[model samples]
Target chain A: MSGRPLRTFAVLGFATTHTALAAEQLLRDLGVPVTPIPAPASIGNGLCGIALRLEPGDVERADTLLERAELRVAARGDIEDV
Target chain B: MPASSSPRPVAYLDHGATSWPKPEQVVHAVTRALTDLGGNPGRGAYAMALAASRAIFESRRTCAELLGVPDSSDLIFQPSCTAGCNLMLKGTLKPGDRVVVGSMEHNAVARPLEHLARTGIEVVVVQGDRTGLVDPDDVEREVRAAPTRAVVCQHASNLTGTIQLIGDLADIAHEHGALMLVDGAQGAGHVDVDIGVLGVDAYATSGHKGMLGPQGVGLLYLSPDLDVRTQVEGGTGGGGSESPDMPIERPDRYEAGTANTPGIVGLGAGAAFLIAEGARQHRRETELVYQLIEGISQIEGFRVLGPPAGAPRVPIVSAVHERLEADRIAFALDRTYGIAARAGLHCAPWAHRTIGTVDCGAVRLGVGWGNTSEHIGLALRALREIVTS
Candidate 1:
C-alpha cells in the first residue's frame, strides 16, 4: 500500500454558519488543526453549509472543545476528501 | 437670534443622545466593511462570504470581550437598545406576569413595558430617591410582595447620570426567582460594566451612545441561564432552511434577517478603542462632569441634578434654571455659545417627574470620550451668561 494520507476525515456540522465559524476559531485557539469545509450533503441535519473538518484522530478532542465552548454541534460524519 | 460673543468651537455635549465624531478607527472600519467586505455574511460559501463572516465574527469577539461575555454567541446585534428591550421584555414575560422597573427608565424600556401592559402584563414603577438613585431594598420589597418575572433598571440614568447598584439588584432578583435586565445605553462605554460581575440576566445598550460607535447598531447580551424566546423571525443566512422556525442555536436564534455588517464592524472598532483608551477617557470625563456640576450649581438660579460632587456618577450633568425654561437655555447654548446640549423631557418623562422638573424640563450636558476641560469651561461661561442676560 502506498503511503498516501487517508481521504476520510471527521467533520463537525452546526445549525448555523456562525457556530461553524465559532467552532473553527475555538479549535484553532486550542491548537487543534481544523479546516472549514462545505458540509457534505451526506450530513442531512446540517443547516449551515459550512462545517469543520479535522483529522479523524482529532474528533474526540474537537468535540470536547466545541462542547466546552457551548457551540451546538448539529451533526458529525466521516466524509471523504472534498 | 444673532451669533454672539466668542465663537468658540461647538462643545457637542449631547453624547447622552448619541456620540458625535466617532473615533477614526470606527470610521475606517465602517468604510472598509461597506467597500471591501461587502459580501453578505453567512450567505454562501464563496471567499467574499467567508471574509465577511470572519469580519463579523471578529467584531462579535471584540464586543464579547468588552462586555465580559464568556461565550460570544450569547451577544446579539440589535438595531437599537429599544429593540433589545422589547425582545427581552416581551419574549420572557407573559400575560399575568409582573415586572418591576425604576422610574428613571428611558422610553426605550418604558414604552415597551407600556405596550406589554396593554396586553395584561403588570408593570411596577419603583420611585428612586431625589438624586435618582434606586434602592435595592425597594426592588427586593416589590419582588417579595409578588412573583415578578423580571426586574428592569438602567445601569446609569440617561437624564440624571446616577449609577445604579446593578450587582446588588441582580442578587435580589435571582434570590426572588426573577430575571435582572439592565438598560446600559449610557453605562457601557461611559463607565466600566462587566456582565460577568454584574450578573444581569440580560443587558441592552446602544452602540452609538457611550460605546462611541455609529448609529443604527446596538448590543443585547443574554445570559447562558436565561431562555428568552425569539422576537423576530426571518432568514438567518444558510441555516435551518428546512425548518420554518428560527434555528435553536444562538447568535442566529435571536438575530433574524441579514446581519448589519458595517454597523457591527464599526461597533467592534469602537469596543476595541474602549479596551485600549477607555480608562483614561473615563477619568477625564468624570472630572469634567464634576466641574460642570460645581460650576453650574454656583450659578444663582440653576440647580444641578443627580448625585453630589464627590459621589460617583457617569459623565452627565443636568440643571434646571429657576427663571428660564430648559429649551430656551439649550437654544441659547447652541446659537450663542455654539455648545450643543439637550433639553425637554429627554425622552424620559418619568425621569423628569422624579426630579420635579417635568413641567419645565432641564438642560443636560453629556460629556463624552473626547471632552476636555476647555469644553466644560466654555459651557459654564455660556450658562452664566445665559442665566444673567
Candidate 2:
C-alpha cells in the first residue's frame, strides 16, 4: 500500500436520484476502506462529481462487491500520485 | 487537421455530428496546404494561386465522388450547412411558391423555411412518426396538397440518428413536380449517399460535421436539370466582365466571394480518408449502437428513444431513466464519471415535439467510427449506476 498510490475506479451507471445516498449506503455495506474521489479528466468515467477511490490493493474486492450489488463499473484507473 | 501521432485511449463517440480525431492523412493534407499552397484559390493568376485552385478543384472532385455526382463543377462550397441551405432556399424559391419540410429537420433547414414562410411562400411541414420515421407517402401527400416548389428534408435526423428514405421521398416529390432538397448534415459521411442514384434536386451538407473537416465549410450539390437563381452576385475568378449581375453559370453563379479554401481542402482530405477507409464501415459502427440500445433497453427503468431496434438508423441513441431528469443524469455522468454526452433538445424542437421528449429532452449518445464495444459497455455501466442508484 505504501509503494502503490491510492487507485480510483468509477462505478459506472446512472447515479439516479439517490446517487449520493446509494453511494453512502454501498460504502457502508461493503465495510471496505473507500472515499469519494473527484471525477478524473483522463478517464471520462462519469458526468457527475461522484467517483470512488480505494486503496490500490482493495480495488479487486471493491469491484466484486459492487458487481454483486448489480452496479456497473464505469472505469478503472490508478490514482496518479501528485 | 493538425497532426498528432501519439495515440490515446479516449473513446470518441460523436462521429454522427463530425468525425473526431480525423485520420492522420487528412491532417497531413491540411498541413501540406497550410505550408505550401497558402494563396487565395481563385483570385490570383500566380503559381501559388494555381496550386490553391488545384486543391479546391481536387476537393470538389472528391466531394463529387462522395456524392456520386459526375461533374465536380456542379458542387459549390459554402461556410456551413446553414449557409448552404440559405443559398439553395434563397436562390431557388420565389415568394409565391410552396415549400414542404419534414418535422425532424434541423434548424438549418427549418429556420430558412420559417423565414420564407413570413413571406407569401407557403410552408407545409410533414410530420414523422413518434420513432422519428418520416413516411414518403406523407411527403407525397404534402407535395400534392399544393403546388410545392421544393420539398426539403434531412437525410438523417441529427437528434435521433434516424435515416430518412431520401430516394423514395425524392421520387414522391418529383412525381408532384417539386424538387427535393436534402440536409445531409448527419448522413453524408456516416452513410452511403449517391446523389446520382437518389436523383435529389439539391443536397446540402456541412464539412465540419460528418465530413470530418474544420468548420466554415459546406457543400451544395445541384442537379443538372434544376435551374436555381443566384443568392448573391460577385466575382468567381473566371474572367467574366465586372458586371453587377450574377454570373450566368452553375457553380460560379452560386458561389460568391472568397471561398473557405483551407476548410474545403481539409474536407477533400476528409472525404479521401472516408473513401480509403471504406465508408461502408458505418454500418458496422451502427451495430455498436444497436448493441447499446439492446443493452440499455434491458435495464428496467431506462427507455430508449428514436427508431426501433434493428430499424435503419445511424449510430445515435437517445435515452433517459424514468426516475431521473435527462439533464441531471447527463450532469451526473459527466461529473461523477468521464462520459462525454449531449443532452436536451439537440437543436431540433420539431423532432423533440414529434417524439414527445420536448419537456425533458432525451440524453443523446452518438457513436462514431472511433467508438468501440468497450466504450459502449462502459457507457452502459455508467448509465446503470446512475439509474439504479
Candidate 3:
C-alpha cells in the first residue's frame, strides 16, 4: 500500500545480515548497486544492525529487486519527511 | 571449604524468573532508544514523535515475525505478559461463559480466570498428569460436556518444565466452538511457536523472560477472526483528542496511553537475535539443561520434580531435598556459595500441587544460553555442601 512519505531519509528496509549480504551479492550479479546502512536506533538494527538504504524514487525498483531475489523486506518506508 | 576460601563465583540459574546477562545487543538497543530516540510514540506531530512511532511499528513487526503471526497489527504491546493475559481474558470472555484451564497455569493466566469467575464466568480447572502436562483429550471432554466459550492453557509450565501440546489442544477447542487462549510466557522464545501450525486463537508472552528484551514490554497475538473488547480507554493519538471514545483501530483501541518505546525497541533487537540464532541458542540451552539436570540428579537427598528423565520440557528444573526446606536450601546455596536460585511456590500453587509438592515448594533452577557446565558444577557443589552441613 502506497502512503505519504514517513521518514526523513529516502527509503529504508529491515533484513538479516545473511539476507543483506546475499542481497548485495545478488544485486552485483544483476548489475544493480545499492548501499545498506545500520538502521537508525528508532527503527531496528536488523541482524547485522544494517538496512538497505534506497533513494526515495527507487522504492518501486528496490521492491522489484527484492521480490526477484525472493527476499522479504521485514519493514520498509520512505525516510523523506512528509 | 570455609569463608576464607572465598565463596564460589555466582551461578545465576534463574532464567525462568527473569533472564539476566542479556545479549549485548539488547542492552545497546535499550540505551540507544533512551538516549537517541527520546520521543513519545504516537503522541505528537514532530519528527521525533513520528520516528518513535515508526520504531514501535518496526518492533511490532519483528515480534509478529517471531511468533509466526501473519499480521503484525494483531500483535498488541502490553506492559508485561501478566497484563496481556488480563487483556485477553477480560477482553474475550463475558459473564456466564465457561472456560477450561490446565492445572499448572501460572498466576498470569490463572488469576485473570479467577477474577473472571468472580464476575460470573465459569472457570473449570482440568487435571494435568503427574508430570504437570495437561491431557488434551480430557480438556476436549470438558469442552464437550459444556458449552465452553474458551480454553486457557500455557505453552510451558514455569515450575515443572513441562511443554504442553498446544496444537492438539487448539484443535479440540476449535472442534467444540471454543477459543484457544495460550499463555506463552514460558513458550515464545524457547520453542517453535508458529501460530498457524499451532492453531491457537490468541497467545500472550513476556519480553524479558524468553525474548531477552527489557521487563516493561510483552506481546499479545489475536487471530484475525476473533474480536475482543478493550479493557482500557483514553487517548489513542488517533487525531480525535476531543472525543473520549477509544479509537476503533486494532492496537490503538487496546493501547490507550504513551507506549513503552524503549522496552519495545529492546524487544525488537532481542527477538531479532532469537529469530536469527534461535535454533543455535535453543540447542545451547538444551545441552546446558541436560547437563544441569544430570548434575542435580546426582546429589543425595535431592529429587527433581516431574517425569523420570528425557521428558519433553523446557530448560527449567525444580528440586526439593528430603529433610531440608526448599527455601532453606536455596538460602544456603546463596549464602555459602554466591549462587542465585528461586525457591518458593513460584506463584503457581497449582503447579506445586500437581507435582505433589504443595507442602514444600521446590527450588527451581532455569538454565539458559549463558549457563555452562561450570555453573552447574558450582550449583551442584553448593547443594552437596548444604546437604552435608
- Scoring only the A-chain of each prediction against the true A-chain gives TM-scores of 0.86, 0.63, 0.63
**Which candidate leads in lDDT?**
1
lDDT of 1 by residue, B1-389 (tens): 33546544378899899997799999999999989888888876677777888988899999999989988889999998889988888888899999999999999999999999999999999999889999999989999999999999999998899999999999999999999999999899988888999999999999999898889999999998788889899888655677888887788888888888899999999999999999988989878988898899899999999898879998889989889999999999998878989999999998889878889898999999778899899999999999899
1 against 2, candidate with superior lDDT: 1
Put down candidate 1 lDDT per residue, A1-82, tens digits, no spaces: 7676759998888887778888898899999998877777677674556778899999888888888877778877888875
> Any residue pairs clashing in model 3, and if so which?
A7-A79, A7-A80, A8-A79, A9-A79, A45-A49
lDDT of 3 by residue, B241-325 (tens): 4445664546666887778889999999888989998899888888877877787788888888875577768889999889989
lDDT of each residue in B2-72, candidate 2, tens digit only: 12433332454556556677767677877888888887665553567657766777788788898798766
Give stretches of model 1 more than 4 Å off.
A1-10, A30-32, A54-61, A64-70, A78-82, B1-9
The DockQ figures for the candidates are 0.46, 0.01, 0.04
| CAPRI quality band, candidate 2 | incorrect
Q: After superposition, how far is residue A42 of candidate 2 from its true place, in Å?
A: 63
Models 1 onward score TM values of 0.93, 0.78, 0.82
Off by over 4 Å in 3: A1-82, B1-9, B239-243
Candidate whose TM-score is highest: 1
Candidate 1 RMSD computed on C-alpha atoms after optimal superposition onto the true structure: 3.2
